[model samples]
Target: MSPVSETHLAHRLNLRLNVEPSEIGGIRHTVIQHIGSWECAAIADDVILVVSELLANVHEHAEGVCELEIEHQDEGLVVKVSDTFMTPPTLGHRHGSAETGRGLLLVDALTDHWETTITGTGKVITCTFGTPGRGISP
Candidate 1:
């Protein structure tokens, strides 16, 4: 028998999380469990942080539920976190010794490709991280 190809193995998982103020930890653990199943390398670890930041942002500012969608492509995993916040995310040093304000910056540092798109109702932050041995630098 032959091993399954990476392309055949990477699976896509999508999640919608409420922007509750206190569920960030639970959300992060859920994402880790879901994505960690994949044989992808450090990509899972990188994604865990990204999801935490994204969800934290949503809980802090967004007014409605936050949606998190993850698609595992042949080359890597694509994560999209959408919220109904009107203000755009600015990547810079956090205001001060604040515990927050640095989520987006962290995402930028971890992911290979990332972008933000504004929609009629809100905004969607998308990031992609490459898998370990599949020719990516996760």
Candidate 2:
């Protein structure tokens, strides 16, 4: 018997979350479970942090509801959070006065690549993290 290859299969979880503050922890937990099911626990911790930040941003800044989609693809995990917000997230210059403005920065630092997609009804923010946790730094 041989061990399964890391990227042998694809797994996806699509979630529609009501942009409420209380359910964030639940969502995070579910995401962790899904990652575990896909046998990609190596990146589980990092994925949870990324999901938490993404959902928090949606609840705080975006309008209406949100959709979370996680997929295991091509030796990486694609985390996409969609919401009804027009403004794209930016990595602005944070001065001493800025109290809390580093969510995307953290996401970007922990993932292989990330980007934003604007749709007709809303926007989607997608972050891609390579398999087995590719060079992640806190």
Candidate 3:
């Protein structure tokens, strides 16, 4: 069978919110709403989850404000989460008694691709998930 054609668009949404602990869910919802009309709902959800984790981390550890920018691509959505915290995120080992270090770990598990870039202001964690047609069948 031929490769399926996928709907695609590239745009960016900026989320500005207080780094207060309670704002993480709002950030996630913002992302979901922004991506709702895309044909890649599954990928959108994955990106939303990753974005949530990163934002939560900022709320728990960072200061002042946190921002998120999502770029929708043909194959997937690219998510970037930035905060004032200069320290890199810790992907704590869950094998032990650690109950609270799995944010980035979850991002790793959910996204098909991800990476972190240290910016002049802070670090931006980028993650991506493939849309339906981009899936490769074995």
Candidate 4:
């Protein structure tokens, strides 16, 4: 099935998929392609990591399908991942030796700003990354 939907115009892509570990790679590639086409390739690595972390969280914590919305703005790119779980994710405090619980930490380190908003059905985690000299904190 086509995970991408043409709901938004240029510079925006919306994907709704069943959250699964096997699908994460395909989703990451889709985001990378869109980032390249949007002329935001400079931040592609960070974006890919952020998307992977977010999708992993959904697959592990949430139930069923999730919606991934990516939009490229003048400053940078915005990624919003909405899942059917109402519980908001916390910034995990994993020890250096721990193997799990570093997803949110990676997101926090990569994104300029990120937040979770609760909807009637679920929660949406929005991550923003800004380009150089675009008001992103150092």
Candidate 5:
């Protein structure tokens, strides 16, 4: 997928919000709206799905306040969820009739690249989804 174009991405990015389990739905809606407004509906579902999955991990495995930030950079839209969990999250596999353990898997597929980093206070999961932003890859 092409990037959204540097000009448009710069205009739509730099967003940061505090999020929790209770707030995921609303935040998801708002982010999707932003994506749609930018005429990036093609990747809207993928963006929301990845964000939800990341936040769900935060809710299940971490604690304290988590910050969700969406930014447009280089050739992709970057979504990050940071929380107070020093331990890095691990992707798991559960076969047959499993309801969980699929969030990270979904995230892995939707984003071109993703990784978790250890922050001073906790950890942050950052995933990059290729967007319509037309820019040099970074």
Candidate 6:
């Protein structure tokens, strides 16, 4: 998939969040509210889960704060989380007993497409979820 340019997005929301576990619930609520307003219920759950997973990674691995950007595209919603951590995430094979390493796996399963881009400040993990049977407006 080609990178989504800002010009093509119908709607965009950007948020800066502290890397705290307590911040996850509030951010999830915010995302759901936006999804609700967008009338994209068909992919709401998937979008929420993907956002949660990405935020959890930021809280667990990154330092300071992270930026969350959600955009409405012609095909679906694009979610990007930027953090100060320079190392990109990898999908690691973990034992069933492992508790901490499965987030990215869940992210991979839920999103239609996902990629990590290293920036000068840090890295951004972008995820795309296709919305079906619904029309998204600006």
Q: Point to the candidate with the largest lDDT.
A: 4
Best first by lDDT, ranked: 4, 6, 2, 1, 5, 3
Q: lDDT per residue, candidate 6, 1-138, as tens digits? A: 011222222377677777477757777777787887777778999889888888788877896368889987777898999999999999887899986889889888988888999999999998888787534332
What is the C-alpha lDDT profile of model 5 across 10-53, one tens digit per residue? 43543344445777787677777677666667678988999887
- Model 1, span 11-87: residue lDDT tens: 76666666564666666665676676765656777888888777767767885377778877778888888888867
Model 1 CA lDDT for position 17: 61
- Which candidate achieves the best TM-score against the true structure? 4
lDDT of 4 by residue, 68-109 (tens): 999888889888999889999888698899989888888999
Cα lDDT tens digits, model 2, 1-138, are: 011111223488877777566777777777787788888888888889998888889878885368788888657688888889978999766776778998888888887788898999779998887776353221
TM-score order, best first, reads 4, 6, 2, 1, 3, 5
TM-score versus the correct structure, for each prediction: 0.79, 0.83, 0.79, 0.91, 0.78, 0.85
- Model 1 clash pairs are none
lDDT, model 2, position 67 = 79
lDDT scores in order: 0.73, 0.77, 0.67, 0.84, 0.70, 0.79
- Per-model tally of clashing residue pairs: 0, 0, 0, 0, 7, 0
Task: Report the alpha-carbon TM-score of model 3 versus the true structure.
Answer: 0.79
The ten-residue window of minimal lDDT in model 3 covers 1-10
